[model samples]
Target chain A: MQAVEYFEVECPEALGGEYYKQIANDVLLDHNLLKVIDKLHIFIDPKVPVFVAVGLLKKISTRVRVGDFANVNPLEGKMTLVISDETYLASMLKIFWERFGKEKVEQPDRFTVILYNVPATPKEIEDIVVGDPSESLHKDLIYALRCIAPEGFRLRSEIFTGTKFTFVASENTLAEDIDTLVAEKFRLMGEVPP
Target chain B: MTLVPVTYKGGIFQHDIVVDLIEDLGGYIVQKHIIAQEVVLQCFVPREDIELIRQISRPLFGEVTDSPLVGTEIAIVSMSLEIHHLPHPSCDIAEYVRRLGAKSNMVSLARGPGKRIAGLNDEERDVINEHDIAVYLMGNFETCIEYKMPTLRRGIEVPIVLCGGPDKEVLERIIDPPVEGYVGNVGRFMRRTKEADELAKLDEIIDEITRVLEKKREEIAKDPLSVYPARLMGLIREQIPEILDVTSPTPLTVQIAGLRVKLPYDTFAERVKKVAIEDGITLGEVAEVLPSRMRDYVIVKVLPFSETNIAV
Candidate 1:
């Protein structure tokens, strides 16, 4: 069986460092992957109670295309979207409705939706604006990524977008060289370079 | 030879006491068995030496140092509608007692059978008296235990331990002839705990039961049997081969002096008479075989050889 890597992150300002740590520990233990040499970092910004957890994405099968998650077809005038993964269909539709108001959205089936007047490239639709990005949104995205990542990975990095903020998590900060400047700041916090 | 019932693992302490007490009294164990419940069934000492064995075991009585709740057979008297809660206390107490090497049970009184009506029923009364100890689990209200006392007031000469959620003092004040004592903290319905503090209360209950059994041992010694059951069983086994094949519900019952052997009334009498010793004296020559008083079973009692002037 292919090993799955899992990680979790939270913005301390939105959820708190202790909460993310508890969630991380719980998830890691539940998955029986605590011993893996994955680097997990929880970042707490002094300006706000922002906490972010970042870890590496360890396992991925190149054979399974991303289109398996949702249908990608280039149509004239706009790109059409059809989802085959029924489980994520609701969330995808919710995102679609938030970006394109309910009046403009059309759902023909449980797992099928059409985004009107969209670019041929589906990645552009993925980048469509829904809700304004906030610290909580970044934390939520990290949490979702942690839920999706395979279990074996140890290193990860999380970046906060507000004020051009960035957070990176990895197995070894010293070996990976995330940022020499950032390492100095972390060194002052008594964090040994790994 | 006598039959001593011992508990396994957790009951090691009590098992030692019972073994020592039996051997020290010059009583031999004819049969040994393990009883899972708090009450044990023992057939010890011949009919003639029952009083002696009782006397020897008297000193070990009433040491309730162990949890009063240990070895207690609780009857969760509740309605059919409340059957879900039956397992709650039984599992809780059973798990607690298991740690101490004891056992408990949760018995449900028949539906439409309140305490008063059920208390008067012969079957219910017999079951209540059958156990060495009983716990009458009541509801939260004081009146529940009070009103239910009448149903539980059968000929239960053994300890009747009470348990409910109410404060111990409040229950004591409300129960008129008050039960042995009320156990508390049985009301909390929550997750299982492995913490020592969580089990302390149950330990206290087990201690109470041990104390009560000890006291009973004292009272039983007041008038001991002449010959213990152990000696009688040995004599019966040596003399009667038919007993081995004669299967009755309770094949061996611990009597005051000798154990009672229940065999089929019609078929085994002749074979029982044919059992003889090396010198060729038959069992019929020493013991009397007559119809049992309570059931369609034969009752055998040892008659002194001197009385019959026979030696095998």
Candidate 2:
């Protein structure tokens, strides 16, 4: 496929523009294409420590939740969901069992499950779960991206869900000020700050 | 006389050089090739031959050059960028070079290891050849390094060392012009040495490269530079105002006695003359500022007309 877009950021002075360039070039030149897009969408977060470039991949989403990802419908006042793709099966099951209790959810098929007495609002059900599944989603996405990115990229990413979920990937050069770096990079790219 | 039956599994850029070094130091290449599968077996002769084999194979196997890419120590750049393991062949070679008191670069061809592997691009080839010396690690059992002769066989101006896992005879016979040298080892896929033992082998390789580098240093001593690069850097900083904006800390560094100014040659040549010492001697009057042989940086060398004719 043709490269539809290209983005780059001038790293902050703390990140050493030259040093960041070396790492960026190393990652860009070495990334694997079969699993992930080699080209990056980069922007400098001025709020970040100098010499760091925060990157985002637009239009590429690998998030899977119970109702958000698969078909969830009501039957006899209960929710019968058929998850064709069990991307977050473990987290989904954990959330389901914790909210509905282990006896309330039954799995007849490998990818299909039935939930009884589930709340009408999926958001309400999502909230009942003690731990946030979005964290794991972010981690999975980061792991996938790392497997796809070049070795030199040394990527560190954080995924979050509010109205919409965002996946942020960055080179791990800035150990302490990663959040600032990422925010600044997003601002530099004109992305709305979290 | 002593053949250590050294084996290297993967393919590298300077495999030929390693083979040549092994033979020159009195080691015979036992078996060599790119490792296609996960495992392979090799046999060794008497332990007495180990020294001769090691001496010959030492230069072939250990680190021999200072790697400009990774500044501190030698590290192997594996063929598959995904794999991260200890005793990384590229890192092993890099350490080998460092032990010899020279820098080493672990280079992986753009295409991963295989018989149909691609050669280095122009930029990559230039970087690989830029080293004072290079150790190319090739694949084990696979013929990618040899078959892709056009990639590595191009005339290398400096010593291009080579290493692989097959018998030395295979490398000698297959390589078109043949590499500078070759070393045998278990295939790249197979972990040859236990953690501690592998480190010991790496240390041995480093020792061999040090000896070679020492000899090279002696040869270079015949004619010393009138001025060292660091001295010129200080002089240029004091003399030139425009150099401050160049950005490189080690700006106006030297490669073989000539100064390499990080400033753009085309834009800065005329402006550089503004730099003058307290004695009113301008840089232009003492040295010729021109484009570098390799990059866009300005190359400066003292001309015979300079008051200080000898490099201080």
Candidate 3:
């Protein structure tokens, strides 16, 4: 019935477990990460002073590229790109300057950009990958996890792949087997440790 | 005179009459303000004459209700300013108590999280004790709240009203002294307390606070102070013209049992003690003027009749 397919919280204290589940749901929903997370499992040990969270992310089918957010047109040896979405404009400009140099790229206005004497065709420019939603999603997802974690659990260890993530936090230094704890949580969610 | 605390809210029409009536009856008008078209008055009137005060306000389209918090300062205590306990229930509790005529201060403890490593220092405890009472905003877990609270509550010397997530009956069942100062369902808001249920819970918390304040009033009534705090506010302002220059909006902030004079204690403590009252007795003869732990302000705690053998 919920957007997320699976969400589970495990703790020694029953009330603490229920409260943490509510907190996790609220934090994820507030951060707009509920839909993108397919499964989430959290394990908290107040006595042991550890909190572990493991989550499986939904498959991101759409890869944002230059063509997806801008219109490309060939004019002589140069190409002009008129951006329709500016959410990734800053990152796009950074990539352009790094790849084609500032001398070859010129942004005249907010949405207009001109490439001069580029060897690549307009189609090649359109194919350039500029935005990765998963990259920012990982950051936001980790932030929401921290919000869900117990207060004063400042020490953190995080692992974020394109399709999976595991976050461990503690008031003291994290345990040496923090990965095992995360793997145990992932296993609770019916996922392989890998 | 049996002073009964109350508040009034209605139109501005004939509101001056109510003020005049309170003054004529020798009652105190603690605070009165006009917010746009409406006027709000928080005052204390003679107990037997309360009906008369209400009757005079009826024609002004105003209502008078008993609310002991009208002239007191309250502290809303939380674990810390961390994401766990701040800007949610702390803000909500402070706003609710302030809306009901009490001066509410949000007091966030410096290290008031985690059961083993959490505790409040002497200064933090004193700051919270400066108010009439403290309302502790805690998290959702029942066991954690019970176990972790005493550490955060260390050295605090004031009545504490708790607001948390666990059901009141359950909390009262477990906590010693039978927890009359517990309000539930107001824990850790993801948003503002704008929803009807959230506001209802806030109202419940305020009602609990009023009950606690009324209890304090009853205790004070047993051995009444020689001079009421509100009366001293006027005397302090009149005799000590220097207080008028003080930047605090309320130079003599009203507490349930005393007053917090904003003047520096080192220079003004002796001067405040020498303030003369009725019957040829100096203020020092009937009250204990102590250097307040809060900002070195002088605290004028009027002696009870049992101690001073005088009552006004």
Candidate 4:
């Protein structure tokens, strides 16, 4: 029941309600945002020259680790890794090459990686972090928000959190009540403002 | 229904034959330009006789294609040529208009963004007025659209078609005195329009242009000029051999009322005015020859026979 895949974009009555929904959908898909975000609400008031976007990010529990992406088998002094997901293979190889030097790490096939000098415990490779999706999500969300905002709305104030992000942008001077307005928009979208 | 637009591209050697054939078919040449050894003529052939013009083009090593809006010019006006106003919906619409055979000019103004600074200057207005119809792409808010109408109303004299992202009702409510037409579903589109809805919107804009142009054509028929703009262009090219040396792709551009000769107004204005036509009549007698608004070039507005009191 908590997992409501709700995404809504609202424009001021002056700007025409639901007018920018397609544009919002386009910008979201263009940035490949459908994979990470579960709910999004965008509010635009052309009269105030303000654009606000609030999104709820789906939880990414752990970083991409070497053990999750590859199978490491140690035999003698060398170790072989048969990768399952190539998405983190480059990062995993970078870390392996850094520790064992370039000459020791060899990838002959797309999925097989061989290390000449294996450490005492081959399972130690399991704890190595390849990448974090949440970190990149923060970056990509801002990008998607930029594409949806008005062209003249250059000044932006973004509030980024672990699970949610709220961005407010405007061309003119930010009035003192901008925070209130953003909160009001979030409330309208059924979001408990942070 | 009277004139059907067509484009002919062929070699320069036998181009005159094609031109004569088009003339014999009761067709008029809107624009003629020589690109290297090749010549391209945009024409308005009689709708019923378009097939005859096509047949003549076949023997002349020419390619003839339908260009519906060839004889007319349209201006797509926006505040800036930057990422906001251009290369998106405006450029997309302009390209669409070009495909329909009308000459589309993208008019970008300096300081054209922000409600406080978005207004056209005299030079910009002159450039827009040169076109047959001006399409002003308004913004979202009705109040903003209303605020900007005065600048366009004061500067533009030709028919105007207001286009925006809002509904037709919203756009109509804001515009005063009623423009020639109002087209909705066109604005600052960041991406291309390939969807069914967006394509339908483009069709609507083209329909508005057709309606507005039809009205203007009827008005022109009521009080027709002594010479058509295309005919006047042909006369200028023949009488003034010096125009060939100008080297501009389009030394003379045909307009609704007259033509704009791309020559310095001071030196060439008098020569253009003195051009003698077949009737042993000077251009100055049937036209108001003066300097253009954008540049020093001459702007010739051929007067109606009722005004000049001489029927051609």
Highest lDDT scorer: 3
**How many times do residue backbones clash in model 1?**
70
Two-chain DockQ for each candidate model: 0.01, 0.03, 0.37, 0.21
Q: Write the per-residue lDDT of candidate 2 for residues A149-185, one digit (tens) a residue.
A: 3233343455444322233433345466556755655
Cα shift from native, residue A95, model 2 (Å): 5.7
Which ten contiguous residues of candidate 3 chain A have the minimum total lDDT? A13-22
* Best of the two (1, 4) by lDDT: 4
Residue A134 displacement in candidate 4 (angstroms) = 7.9
Q: Weakest 10 consecutive residues, lDDT, candidate 4 chain B?
A: B111-120
lDDT of each: 0.48, 0.47, 0.81, 0.78
CAPRI level of candidate 1 = incorrect
Q: Order candidates by lDDT, high to low.
A: 3, 4, 1, 2
TM-score of each: 0.39, 0.40, 0.84, 0.74
| Descending-DockQ candidate ranking | 3, 4, 2, 1
Q: Which 10 consecutive residues of model 4 chain A have the lowest summed lDDT?
A: A11-20
Better of 2 and 4 by lDDT: 4
TM-score winner between 2 and 3, please give it: 3
Off-target runs (Cα >4 Å) in candidate 4 are: A1-4, A33-38, A57-144, A152-156, A160-164, A188-194, B1-17, B32-41, B46-51, B54-68, B113-117, B239-249, B293-298
Superior candidate under TM-score, 3 versus 4: 3
Model 2 Cα displacement at B124 (Å)?
2.9
Residue-by-residue lDDT tens digits, candidate 1, A1-194 = 12423333433234233333444454455444444313444453323212234333233223323355666665665556676666546655687667667766677777667666643367666444333223244455455435422211235665543322234432223244446645544444344443
